[model samples]
Target chain A: MLTRFENRPHALDVIGVSVAFGEVCVIDNVSFHVDVGSTLAIVGRNGSGKTVLLKALIGAVRASGTIRWAPETRIGYVPQKLDIQRDLPLTGRDFLNAKADVARAPATDAQRVAGLVNLSQSIVDQPIGTLSGGQFQRLLLAFALVGTPSVLLFDEPTAGVDEPEEKSVYALIHQLQQNEGLSVLVISHDMTQVQASADHILFLSHHGSYFGKTADMLNSERLQELHGPTVAHLRE
Target chain B: MTYATGPGAFLIPLGMAAAAGLMGSIAVMRRMALASDALSHIALPGIAIALLVHVNPFLGGLIALVLGTVLVWAIEYRSRIPTDVVVGVIFSAALAMGSLLASGDELIEALFGAPNTSDSFNLIGLGAASLVIVFIVRYRSQLVIRLVSPDLARPAGINVPRLDLLYLLAFALTIALGLRYLGVLLMGSLIIIPAATAMRLGTNLRTMQTISVAIAMLATLSGMLLAPVLCLAAGPLVIVIAASIFFLSLAVRRA
Candidate 1:
């Protein structure tokens, strides 16, 4: 029996999604759906295709299947590379002066600094080149906040950030979800952030694996068989 | 701070070089550096064939540009050549065919390369001519950065393959025209090197890009003077200077 996940579309849905690079399939014949305003976290090993799956959903990277975003869906993404380019001439102002309107106005250096209150103001006027790692990440985060995207995708959001900074990021994400009901999808290996933020977890193994509530997914027998009850121990 | 000695002698190379730098930087950052170069080489066959057929080289380059972009996209997105290796083969073959096809009296000059006989007036005038296209696609520069962030660029509604096409067309036109000044062997290098050198030191994309243009401008002026003094080919000389800048930045990065 086929699941109706493919038959009809919600706000955003993926059916029979298959993405491949060379001979190997990263996302092999997978299908999933997300309800409006729900948060889903994808978990897997480094090469386990979680990122590919997320990318497929956003229709960025190619996949063979149907991925329908809700009408007028504006998707935001923060890539794995945080310190992307500090040397671009754009002041923080230039970054916000973009197509989307997720953040507050004034979109100037001062406003951007105020928005990213974590950084000093002097660096705000400085061209993007001089930023530290956290600062760069902050800049992209601010960009992500712009345009009030209907959905947000963070690919390894905390990969290089410090622990405290990760907490701040999670805090911001939580605020977005709570205040605006921002439909968010996070791809990460960090167990705690997933447990903390993810309402739903999609554990993608070599093939499409699990999709359910985070707690339920964690409590599943396969996870226990694979990781020897580390998920249970983390409950404490 | 090493400024050129001659009055406005820098303008000629500056015009062509800056255009090349901007285009090439996008190519390099997108990891489509080889693809752009290959497309440039591919233009050779089209232009040469067009010349044989008594048509416009620019028109020919356009055809090559279309085919080149499609070929790379097919090889890159659709096929399994691992992107990098595929482009490598594409460029080598394209350059070979370009060299072989662009034969005749103009052929020698094209392959071995030639110095631009176009005066400062002509070069600067052409630069002005190209500004409209630049202004129209200015939004593209911002969008291009997203392409560099393979993770971020695509989902932002930036069709990667389409941008690749746009880039290939722009590069083909630029490359076909630029070959007159920068020449075949070294034009591709000059197009992208200044920006790449700056990327080493600069922390932000904008600063790196600005400095890249500035550096390319400097290298061009210096090469003009240095080529005569050392009795060397202008293109290779200019490339050497640019290469030195890259190494200098890498050293500074390590230091």
Candidate 2:
């Protein structure tokens, strides 16, 4: 899918990057590169340091070794389901306006990104706590889109959304990638979406990791060894 | 002692109450209700020490509150402990120590506040209260983002640690502003009750803040006016009014 970007400049490069908390080594010697305007899917089982790896890439956590991004790279991050109180007084518009103000984006950017995510004005005006799971996901997407970031990092973007809305969320990400020319790094458990959208797959596990083209990784035996019998369905 | 009852006397408390409303809204949203309440108690020991040393108790309380804020921030940052836990342990100790140091009427006044005896420090308190309001309004966007998630705020170009420090400082200042009227025992109530009420009734950020400020000012005005008439202390009366509003807000169903 991303073959067109084979000759494009690298958006990110990771060399022997490792993160450890005290005695526990989470991610060790992980290395990969993402091309501009391509999507890289990070697939792994729970507690496999997938979220930690994303944090390292975004400088949210301490990691040893080299992880570099293209000069002037701006990243927008969408984290997993946040434990927001149902009675929280913040509206979606307030959340978006906060991002716009901090990012120093124009006043119009909030409306533009809200439109991009297909969030209605009425929905955006409602308190964030009252928003449905899918609406909250869209709000986060609009938040990420506000600064016109060149790259996006999503950690289980649709974790709490319904099955029907999950597909639309990925579709929105795909559409945004095409329209905005974004490079995406996402962590997800849904392999079907990965096969549909990802140019490359980075399979991380307690044993080791495999980083390569999506098709090749799906076909490789190492994926079976690292992912066990679970990934056997992907070969079909 | 001749207590100041001029119109000028009312201005500082009103401004301080408004600042408490604004600061408390963020504090409650951050889920720091217990921590903020405990944080005011840290001022008690400072007041006791100031009385012993023959210094202005307000200055002493302000210094102690600032120091306590920094300590809480540092411990929370270094150990990854929750802010409430850190504040709880530290401020509780301060309260115990304060009770031991001051005695009789002086201690009673420090814990529950006394009527204003002089207007000499009113100007400085008003200025400090204005600074806190300005800080909350100017940096509310950043504060809101940080409250939601530090990771999101960091990516959006906010310095999360620095913002946290500044916010804690503003919170301390607001508490200090109200200490004269509400005392260490009741100041935190003024901050939390109005914001908690606003959280229940407000549909959005703007509404929440507006309602919180209005409730705070109303409570302050009513308590200040009614305390002398009813032969009651203003600090307890103000908190009672704020708590009453909070209880009343429970009756109005949220939209």
Identify the candidate with maximal TM-score.
2
What is the per-residue lDDT of model 2 for residues B114-178, given as tens digits with 9 covering 90 to 100?
75746478889989999999999999999998888888887788888899999999999998888
Task: Write candidate 1's Cα lDDT for B29-105 as tens digits.
Answer: 66565655555565566767777888755456557756875787687766656655765777677777777777776
Model 2, A1-236: lDDT tens digits are 53677799999999999999999999989999999999999998899999999988877899999999999998999999887889999999999999999888998899999999999999999999889999999998899888899999999999999998999999999999999999999999898888889998888888877799888887787677767565776665
Task: Write one digit per residue (lDDT tens) for candidate 1, span A1-236.
Answer: 53322243355777888899779888877766676677778877678888778767766667998887889887777777654443444555445554242133344533543364355556555665556666667767666655566787888776777888877877877776777777788887777878887777877777456677777777788777765454665353
- TM agreement with the true structure for every prediction: 0.74, 0.97
Model 2 chain B lowest lDDT segment of ten = B1-10
The DockQ-derived docking category for candidate 1 is: acceptable
Instruction: Give stretches of model 2 more than 4 Å off.
Output: B1-4
**Interface RMSD for all numbered candidates:** 4.9, 0.8
Where model 1 places Cα greater than 4 Å from the true spot, the runs are A1-11, A14-32, A44-48, A64-66, A81-117, A123-133, A190-192, A206-208, A214-231, B1-15, B28-39, B46-66, B80-84, B98-105, B112-137, B196-255
Clashing pairs for model 2 are none
